[model samples]
Target: MADIQDFKSTPKYETFSYLPPMTPEKIRRQIAYLVSQGWNPGIEHVEPARASAYYWYMWKLPMFGEQSVDVIIAELEACHRAHPGNHVRLIGYDNYSQSQGTSFVVFRGK
Candidate 1:
């Protein structure tokens, strides 16, 4: 017989959910890739409890045509500072495909 009490259901978010939390270096690498691909970068955040919700609050307008990885990192850090208790994610918008190309959590909140 199986014990229901022993079963744990962990919620998985977007990309990289199965892996460990990303470090600052990993995040920078990802942002660099996005920039290299000519994809627009955007920041979104939500409370951990509401991570499963359909939509997260966008930090600001997407950085369309932005090419500086440093600027993106700065914005990400700013978002983290404002919402230290929220889960922060970085998303890449592919202009060629007219859709989102990738998304992953950069910061996991309590």
Candidate 2:
């Protein structure tokens, strides 16, 4: 027999963003690519002092299916502007697996 606690686990996929914030144009291209792969985008943020915290709040709900890159860019920009002094991340969720497929830090500020 196995302990039931063994069944508890964190998300399997939690991709981090690239260092050195990407230009909006490049970010747009990446969003286009992810959308093509059937992934949806979402936003998350954490305090600079709590960078390693596990309680990142949802800045935006998951978006999927034919969503325009422009939409994602808008949300990204909004998140950046709102939390310029914190750490913001862009996450792509995989609907098929209902798990986070990838993520990246979009902004870093003190």
Candidate 3:
């Protein structure tokens, strides 16, 4: 993964999503926390019809505030990259998503 600073500078988030068969409570909380901080989250389905690998998710940390955007993204980028296999999926931009300026780091796992 690239340096966290790179992530922070970027205007768009490297977002991702998943549709697996798992609750992933811990990740859900983390995601919610990030969203509260000012990041966009992707739409999720409860055990969709299509079969998939084990349920998992991961994503780049997006900037929440203008002043803290770089700082937040850098910090989260370091943490996320330090352990790629950890963080779950990050929400993508949608109707209820945040502003266009905000950026997010997104990923998923199985």
Instruction: Estimate the TM-score for candidate 3.
Output: 0.26
Specify the highest-TM-score model's number: 1
* Superior candidate under lDDT, 1 versus 3: 1
> Looking at model 1, how many pairs of residues clash?
0
**Cα lDDT of model 2 by residue, 51-92, tens digit:** 775688789666656478887878877987988887777788
lDDT for each candidate structure: 0.87, 0.70, 0.37
Tens digit of per-residue lDDT, candidate 3, span 1-110: 33234434333213322222234454445555655655444322112212134443333433333233344334544555665554423343433443442222333322
- Candidate 1's C-alpha runs over 4 A off are 1-9
Question: Which pairs of residues have clashing backbones in candidate 2?
Answer: 15-103, 16-103, 16-104, 17-104, 17-105
Ten-residue region with minimum lDDT total, candidate 2: 4-13
Supply candidate 2's per-residue lDDT for 7. Answer: 18
Clash totals in order: 0, 5, 17
What tens digits encode model 1's per-residue C-alpha lDDT throughout 33-60? 9999999999999999989966899999
Worst 10 residues of 1 by lDDT: 1-10
On the 0 to 100 scale, the lDDT of residue 70 in model 1 is: 94
**What is candidate 2's local distance difference test score?**
0.70
Candidate 3 ranges beyond 4 A from true positions = 1-66, 88-105
Q: How accurate is candidate 3 locally (lDDT)?
A: 0.37
